[model samples]
Each structure stands twice: as C-alpha cells, then as structure tokens.
Target: MEGATPPASATATTPDAPSARSAPAGRPAVVVLSSLVARGSVGGRAVVFALERMGFPVWFLPTVLLPWHPGHGRASRHVPPADAFAALAADLARAPWLGEVGAVLTGYFGSAEQVEAAAGLVAAIKAARPDALYLCDPVIGDQKPDGSGGLYLPEATAIAIRDRLMPLADIATPNRFEAGWLSGLPVGSTAEAIAAARALGPGTVLVTSAPAMMHRSVATLLVEATRCLQAEHPLVEGAPNGTGDLLAATFLARRLDGMTSEAALPRALGAVFEMVARSVRAGSDELVLAAEQDTILHPMAQVTVRAIATPKPRAK
Candidate 1:
C-alpha cells in the first residue's frame, strides 16, 4: 500500500505526516494547546502562527473558543465538556505519528480538568520522545485593576497549573505577577524576580514585564541554572494584548532553531517589541502580526541586554 490509495476513513483518521518532499527538512512540529479566538491573535493562534511562520507545522488544540479576547467586553465562550476534552487529548497522545511533535507550548485552559489533560499529553509526548521540550506559559493571573497582583482564574485552576504543569516545563514564561503568585515570593524588584524565576521548577524561566533598570522602561528577565539575563526596552503605553503570547512563541521558535537561551533572548524580545510598537503606532487593539510579518522574521527594533550576578540564597 506504499503507493496505493488508502480508504477514505483511514485517510481521515491518519495524520498528514511531514515528509522530506513536503515539509521543511529537519523542522519538527510544535503542538500548541491553548485558547482560540475568532478574532485577535492570542493563545493558540498566536503560538501556532508564530511557529508556522518559522516553517514549522503546528498541531493546535483549542482549550476554549471565544469570539475575541475577554478584555474586549463580554463574549460568547465555548469550553468543551470535560470528558470530551480528555478523549480528544488521549486520541492525540496515542497517535501513531506522535513523535513528529518535537515541542509543546501550552497556555490558557478552560478548566482545571483541561489542565490535567494537558499534563497527560505532555507526559505522553515526553515518554514517546524523550527529547521533546515543553514550554509552559502560566496564564493564570495578573495585576488587578485595584493596583494589586492576583489570580484571575479560579483558585483550583491556578493550583492545577502550578502543581501539575509547571513542574513538567523545560521553559516557563510567567508575567511578573504570575511569577510572584506561582513562586510564592514577592517579585517587586529585579533581584526578587531573578531569585523567584530560579526557584520556579523549570530549567529556564523567562519573566516578562520584570522590573527594568532604566526609567520608563520594561524588562524581560531570563533566569537559568547557570546565570541570569535581562532584556529591557522603553515602555510602549497603551500596548495591546498578545505581546506575552508572542514573546513566548518567538522565543520557543528561536530556541528550536538552535539558538541558546542567552542568544535567543534579545532576538525574540526585539521581534515582539518591534511588532508591538508598530501595532500601537497604528492604533490597533491587536498585534499586527500579519502586517508586520517581516518584523517577526527579522526584528529591527533595538533592545539592550545585560547579565547580572545571580542572587545567592541567604545563609541559614
């Protein structure tokens, strides 16, 4: 049957595996499980598109479907039933071509149970292909309107991500607030952010919106087992959603492309910074990812990166 046509149902069920004749040689697929919006780039759409643009085929699984981001006013939400979601995840986990997935990037979940399902799939992927990388973007909480940090998702959901997912991540991208919440340590200063990021279970943690050294600037702090790095850029007021998602996706793509964590930091940050600045200048509420595709491919924005001494633990 190598060259013969297969049955219609079998063809429908079978994944269209990548081939040297079709897909880019040596580029493995990225599986992105997160929220999906019909409008605006965020969650799975953001991750999938970023990876695809980098010439990687992406397997996208939507955790929840929305007309648009929740911030843009109340919209109809569709969260799949728990059992159905688990069944779908199990199906993917058992796929014959699962090894095609070289990395997984997960973000927002519709429910705590979905988090558990995602964890199972991650475990399965690792078991099937030990070298697979899992990048967990803990999208549980953020700073509140009252000028304080807190969890936006249900307490149980946050707990599931912290306990079940983060421990499995090779890389964790948490905004400053989520970092503080997950690490149970204050992240008000750069030192605190660096310490907390290291304490997080992942081998590498990228804390977006970390404290900046320059006035009117924001920073993305990367903490690893060996060292810590920071990438700071001027603040873009009225910046829109999807920046964090875009950053995480771009960084993962670059790392998969053979860049070191240190080497990839500025390039990924610069790309997002350029796209975000362009979007803001155009007065768009969403990232102009399509319009500024070149920026994503080759960032022209300026970003300054420096290494700081990793904070040592206090003596007992």
Candidate 2:
C-alpha cells in the first residue's frame, strides 16, 4: 500500500473484447485448468477472462463439471483423475500444439488424482516445450475470516508443487494462507510475507490476498528474485469473489509475454482493485470488471515496485 492509486468506475456495460489499439502481439498460447461443469465461479472465470483479454490465446482443461453455474451454489460431483487426465493429455498431444506453447497455468484442481494428472502434464509440457514457462496458481484456500477451508487437493498436490513443480514454475500465485501453508512459515506480517515467498520460492512469488497491517482489506504482494511489490487496496464490504484468480491470470499472461513482475504486478493489482471498486459503487453483487479488461495489456493504476524485506533462506 506504500504507493497506491485511487479506484475507478465506469458508467456503462463494457465489452469483453478490449480496444484494438491496446491489443498486444499474441504470446505463446496458454493452457488453463478449471472445473468443467462450473456455473462460472468467480475464480475460474477470472483466469479464462484475463488471459483471453490480454491477447493470449487460451485453452482449458476442466477437472470437474458442475451441475449448475459454479457461483450459483454447491459444486456438483467432481471429475475423477483418470477421466480428467486422459482428456488433458489428449489436448496436449494434438499435432498443432507441437512447439508454440509459451506457458501453462493451472487453477482449481479438485482431487488428488487431478493434481497428479496436472503435475505429469506440467512435466510433459516442459519436456516438449523446454522454453515454455510454468505458472501455477495453487487454488487452495487462503485464510478467510469465516474459517472456510480451501478446496482440498491431496497432500500430493503440495508436495508436487513445492518439490517437483516449483522448481520448474517461473511464477507461483498463492494467497496469504496458502503461502504460509505451503512454506510452513508464519505470514502474519509484511516481513513474514516476504520471507515466506523467498523461502518457498521457485522464482517470483505473487502472494494474493496476503493480509497486511497497513490496510483492513486483503492485499496482494509480489516477490521476485530481486523485485517485490506491496500493493494495497481498500476493503470493499461484500465484494465479489475470484479476485485472486483474476489477479493470478493477469500476472501470468504479462510475465510470459515478457513483462517483468514489476510491470505486471501493478497492472494486476490496479486492474482488480478498480474492477472491484466499480462493482461496489454500482451496488452490484457481481463484479463489473469490463473496464479493467485492458489492464491485461496496459495497467491504468500506477504504483511503485519495491523490495521491503531482505530474502532469507529457509531451514531444510
């Protein structure tokens, strides 16, 4: 929150496709994993939406199919690993996908098998496209005030990420709680947050909804090998969900397409903040993020990217 911007709101329904002027050159295509039968939950939709708007062609692998709209209510039964992985592998095997992949971003894995499938696919992608970056938004639950547990992925998922995948991942987007859980550290303060990121880091770690004392609302901070940003947004009571998902997607697309975390972090944070602020002012339960869609390419909100804490090595 050291350098934050004022929020913005729009007056009309904005189109999903952003203006051609700001549209950027296409990057290597990205693949996102989501719930197949989602009612379009906030998290999943945000990933798909942010990637496409940023000028990156996007593909999806649904780990589960919701019986109804995802945000509508409870999730329908999940798609077990065997079924989900077979489908995902087939997509990656297509001849047209041979050499153009730039990155693979995964979110909302629902089962242990699904996590395993995702890990194998991530490895395969790297094997085939050695240059492609891997960005994982481990969609496990972060600490919430209501004590809601994050969606359960088998312990295998965490092990795979920290031990197997993070080494390969160019970036990771974890909320405050997930960061602490994954790193086995206390993330109760900005200092702790910075340490956790570096200690558990594969490379740059984008900690979303990571709590901070400077502001009441949840915060998203970015920590890289050398650059880190502490972005603060005012709390909006009863705001829409999936902000972390949206932020993660935005950051990944920019990073893969060649923006540094310094540039991409502010873009992601500013975009989500303005989008949420607009939704709050409109008195709408759903987010009015159409205005911020362009932030996928050009971030409107400005902030300074700084390193607040020194990186510390973790105990083995």
Candidate 3:
C-alpha cells in the first residue's frame, strides 16, 4: 500500500446522480482496494474512476503503487509495510462510517498479508452493514497469447487470495486461467467454465475471456445462483490491461443500483468492450480512460447476452 487515508462517507442517491459532498447523505460509498499506477488505468485507478463516473463515491485503498502497470516496464514499486497496512485497515474497520460502504471491490494485492487484511476489512464492513456486497477480482493471472503461462502473482499471494479473500466475496471475477487455477478444473468450453465457476464457491462468478460461440469473439460468462449467462462481443487484439478492473467495478456498481446479474452483465461488458476498442483504435499503450469516460457513464456498444440453458434431467 502507498498512502493511507481514513475511509470517508459520500452521497450518491442514484446510479446516474451527480457527485455531491462526502457525507452519509444517500447511497453508501464503495470501497476499492487495489494497486495504483501513476500513469496508467489499472487496478484501483480503473475501479475508482468507473465507480465515481457511475455516480458512486469511492474510498480507495492502494495495495501498491507503481509508475505504470508492470507490463509497460519496470518502475518504482511501493508496498506499504505490512504493519502499517494492517494498522490502516484496522482503523477503517473501526471507523464510525463503516456502514457507509455499500460495496467493496478488491483487485491486485502487494502481498499475502494484504489479502488477510482485506478479508478482515470486508468482514468489518459486512458487520457494520449486513447488506453490503463484496466483489473480488482475483487479479492473479491471464491467458497469454499461446495460453500457456502460469500464475503471474507469487504463489503465496495467489493462495492467500483463494483461501482468505475469495470465500468472503459475494461475487468473484476471474479470467479463464484464474478460474481454472482457482477451481482445479478445465475452462475450455462454456460448460466447463460454468462448472468451474460454481465449484469456485462464490454465489456468483464472472469469467472473462471465456470461450465464445461466435468465432473469433470473446465472451464474459456470468454464473449466478439461478442461471448461466454469456455476453459475447468481438475481441480486441492487443487491448490494454485493466479491462477486468473496469468490468468488476462497473458490474458491482450496477448491482448496487439494483440491477440483477442478468442486466448488469451486458452493460458492464459493453462498457469494457467499447473502452478497449476505442483505446486500441487510438493506438494507446494504456487504457484511454479519461478520453473514454463517456462509455463508462453511458455505454452505446451492443453486446449480445444469452442465457445458457441447463440440460434436462436424464431418464432414470
């Protein structure tokens, strides 16, 4: 973690509401804990901006700080001392305004200790407000071009996320590799992804970069308590990082605004797709978040979402 700040309350009555003063006036604030970058839209930066653009105030906690995403190049990396990080989290847990947190979304972590601290903070928030939602984006790894690379984060950090933070999450967002790694199952097809997601134990799971029915297109798979959904859109090649962070944050925002997973899935996917396409077309190395803020606020891209039917029971 970089700079620690006391969590603050903010007002947001509606999903499309305008920003107001930081207070416990209306909608509860969303707390985002992730990595921060000075020159890129990844981790907390992506999550915070998307949430705020959707009219929700955010309490941002940086798990680490870098000049840019590691993929860009090596830069100054800062992880707050474990003791100080735990202390800050404890302070947040005891804050009088804990009830103001309507939801939380955690992405990349700097260390295994941070994952444990995050679980404690999530528990505290749930205690203060029983209805609060927690979305965990297990930013552990991605499928490389050949789809052979393994976990990007250290094994200890990945294990901590799987063991400590994931079970606490109401919703889990992981890419194909992460889903397979976490569940110890193959996710090569839609059915495999659904089974793996269910086995991952979250009430709901969103698997990005899922296999799609449409050739050359990518899909986002949403496996919830009732049904399975796939939102398919064209895959953008060489797209910038942080789409996962953006999607998780936006989806959580929509859910907080009372949208079901069925409804939220498309909008969140559309926004991410639009942003990625636009950024790629513009040939930017990083996500063109500021230039594409309009997409986040009001996505115009069309994403086809279809409910995947469960097979009928076999004859006895």
| Candidate 1 lDDT over residue span 1-316, tens digit each | 1122212222233344222112235888888999999999888778888889888888888999999998999989999999898878877776666768889999999899998888888877776566789999999988943677578779899998988888889999999999988989998799888888887889999999888889999899999877888899998998889888999999999998899999899999999989989999999999988898888889989899999887555667
lDDT of 1: 0.85
Off by over 4 Å in 2: 1-26, 36-38, 67-72, 80-84, 90-96, 146-164, 289-299, 302-306, 311-316
**Residues 95-204, model 2: lDDT tens digits:** 24434566788777666556655665665555446677878787766556787776365676666555555555678888888888878898878878877887775688
Which residue pairs does candidate 1 place in steric collision?
none
TM-score for each model: 0.90, 0.79, 0.90
Q: How close is candidate 2 to the true structure, as a TM-score?
A: 0.79
lDDT digits (tens) for residues 1-316 of candidate 3: 1122213321223432222212366667998899989888989999998889889989888999899888887778999999888878877766656657889899999999898888878876775676889899999988775857888889999999998887888999999899999999998888988888888878999999888999889889999766898899987899998999999988998998899888889889999999999999999988899998999979999998988986533467
Quote the positional error of residue 50 for candidate 3 in Å. 0.7
Candidate 2 minimal-lDDT segment of 10 residues = 2-11
